[model samples]
Every structure is written in C-alpha cells, then in structure tokens.
Target: MEPIQLTTAVMTIVNASRIIVQFMQNQRLKNQARRRQQHGDEDMNTDFSKATVSSNLEIMVLLGQAHAVERRFWARETSTEWWDHIVLQVWDDSQWLRNFRMRKGTFMELYDLLSPALKHKNTKMRAALTDHKRVAIALWKLGIPDSYRSVGNQFGVGKSTVGVAVMQVANVIIELLLSKVVTLGNVQVILDGFAAMGFPNCGGAIDGTHIPILGPDHQGSQYINRKGYFSVVLQTLVDHKGHFTNINVG
Candidate 1:
C-alpha cells in the first residue's frame, strides 16, 4: 500500500473510535443525571412523609388534651347523692316510734312473726330496710294513714321502699297471722269470756264497722259512704276480754 492511502485509512479509524467514545460519554452523563433525579425524588418523598408523621402526632396530642379537659369538667360538675344527706343527717328513734305507733319490742316481735314469709326482694336498686323497719312501716301505714312519701322521707328510705315494705308486711301478716291471732277453736273459753261480760249463751259478739279507704280502681262509687267518701267494711268478732276471737273483712 502507498503511505498516503495508509495514513488516510488510519485517520478514518481514529475518528470512528473518537465518535464511539463521545457517544459512550454522553450515555454515561445521561445515566448519572437520571440517578441524581431518582435520589432527589426519594429524599423529597422522605421529607414529606416525616412532615405528615409530625402532623399526625400533633393532632393525636391535641385530641388527648381535649378529652382530658372534658372529663375534668364533668367530674367537677357532679352533685352529692341523696342517701348521704338523709340517713346521716336526720335519724331519731323516738321520732321513729312516734311515727310508727309501736314500741321497739312489739315491732321486733311482729317482725319476727312475719319475717319468714315476707322475704321480698326489692326490684329497684336502693337501700333495703331491715325486718323491724319494714314492720314499723307497715304499722305506720295502718295506724297513722300517712302518705308513703312522707313516711319514706322521715324514715330515711325511698318512697318505693316504704310502699314495698308496707305491702310485703301486710301480705305476710294476712297469710300467716290470721290463724294465730284470731281463732275459734277454743269455744268453751270464748263462751266463758262472753259469760263474764254478762252476755250468757253467746259464743262471741260480732260488730261491724266501716274503715275509710282510698277510691278503688275498678269500683270507686261502690265504696262511697254517708260521709261522702270511700270506705271498706270491717267486721270483727271479739270475746269479753276485747281480744279478737274471729274476724271477717271485706
């Protein structure tokens, strides 16, 4: 080959190699730019996530503080209980006996007589009166004819408790004390008692009376009396000693 032609060929080969090297360098620059863009996007995303986490924690803290303030406000606004004022503030035995019209011994005795059958549980959640207190309440209802609310206020119990106690004691007394308190099995003794009262040959003396009662639900007019009020007939039989021997009530 001639020297001039060989030199021209070598120059062409060197230019081609330089072109390839320039293209590779451009590709590497593009790759480095893409890598830097990706890393920048990742860092921005991490910073945004950190900001979001900080905001969420601040919101949770605010909610916790709000709830604590609300709870404290409610707790400070609460009131005292009723039972605390009533049972501790005003309770007297003499006033209790005067209101119930029975001695303590007699009340306890009657309670002992009727307590086995009068085991009634209060459906309402309240402080329950003892057996003696229950009997006293029943006697107060019978003797004084006071309102249940008044009796409850005086006795340091709820009105419902007073009403329930009266009803339970009355039911127990009627069921269990009827046979024991009034009986006619002792006919000779009853006749002798009548004879002592100057009424001979009479087994017993029976008397009829009317007791004032509240208007009944079903028949209010039927119980109206000459006094222009409701009443129930109470018939009683007694021996000469004034003790009840036989009794009938309607």
Candidate 2:
C-alpha cells in the first residue's frame, strides 16, 4: 500500500512538472517575440505567425493553471459542438468530503444556469468565461458574504462581480447548508456547551434584534417592521455556553 501510494504521488508530481515546463517554454517564446517586435524588428512571418498563434501552449498552461489554482475538486464534460460544454464540482468539503459530495452540479450547466446572459454576446468570450477556475472562485466567494471582496481582489474582479457570483451560488448553499434543520451535532460542536445550559434545542438559542439601514426615497413606509423603524431584523443564535451558533440577515 505504501509503495503504491508513493508511486502515485511521484507520478502526479512528474505529470505536473511536465505541464509546468511546457508553460515556461510557451512564455519564453512569447517573451522573445514580444521583445523582438518592441525592438522594431519588422520581419513579419507569414505562415509562422499563424502557426505560433495556433500552437500557443503557454495560453493552455495559463488556462490550466488558472483553473488549478482557483478550482477545488473540479470535474467537467463537453458537448459535441465545440461551442457548448459544462463543468461539475463540489466545494467546502475538505473535512466533510469523506461523508459525501457536498455541493453538486455540472459545471457548464451551472454557468449556464447562473450567467445573467445565458448566451455570451461573443462565442469566444463565452468560452473564456466558462473557465473552471474563474467561475469556481467567483461562485465560492459569493456564497461567503465577507470573503467575497477579499476573494474577488485575489482574482482581480470587482466587488459587484463577486456579489453576482454569490447570488448565483447562494441557491446551492441554501440547498446544502439549510436543507437540514440545524442538526444537534452541528450546533453543539460549533457552539461548545451552549446547548445544555437551558438554551434552545440542540444547544442553541435565538434572539431578534434591529439594525439601521439606509432610508429609501420612493416609499418611506416600506422600511417599517413591527418595531416601526427603518431597520433590518437580524437573528442571532448562540449555543448552550453562548458561543455564536448562526446568524441570519434580513
């Protein structure tokens, strides 16, 4: 078993190294050509230029690397038409992976399902947007409210892109995270003794509170809740010992 594991690990490393080498070679070719062009060497190759553009391995490596870095546990499928495809994967299942595939969907289906414009205005642009890494990061960050901006910054995307990604992925989270009633085990482990000390069920208790929000011009009366203020209602649940169990935003 140990030998087999070691061999598998080595093979994985070797394959990865080969890809990296190919990537470096591609970049070197591009850099040299770019420098030559910048230096005013106007020897424009007729067929060679077309061949080089078509055989751009660096671009391939970049696409692969981008996906590798951004995506976690990704898998995908393609359609007969080169223009159409889908991808599939799960996220946030590192610890829970042993249990099951946490979040589930075909990648292309997911992109198609969530994309504001189902079909890209440009065919080439749509293909690029379907990249596994880019989409995965965007989708994951959106689901995490606080992490959206931070994650978006890492990928050089704006906050709004992150916001849209989150909204798109929010449904998956709701299905996975909220499908089950707050389990006793989940609450107790997270809350740590808050459940037993006369708190609510499964070692958690809930409290309602009001928070201030920006007022609207069109309908001033729209903001009023039972408390009668321009506020949003928030619910916080704590475990038996009073550690935070969950937070709900209105």
lDDT by residue (tens digit), candidate 2, 163-232: 6655545654455445343444464464445434433344556898877666778776877777777877
Worst 10 residues of 1 by lDDT: 70-79
- Candidate 1: the clashing residue pairs are none
Error of 2 at 161 (Å): 2.9
Query: Which candidate should be chosen as best, given TM-score against the real structure?
Result: 1
Query: Each prediction's Cα RMSD?
Result: 27.8, 20.4
lDDT of 1 by residue, 1-250 (tens): 5786576566656655655565565556556655766777666455545655665565555445434421111111222233345332464556546765655566667878888876656534333455656776678778887898787776666678788988888888879998788876578887787788788888877898888888999979889988898898889887767778777777
Q: What is the lDDT of candidate 2?
A: 0.53
- TM-scores of the candidates in the order shown: 0.57, 0.31
The CA lDDT of each predicted structure is 0.67, 0.53
Among these predictions, the greatest lDDT belongs to 1
Residue 223 of model 1 has an lDDT of 92
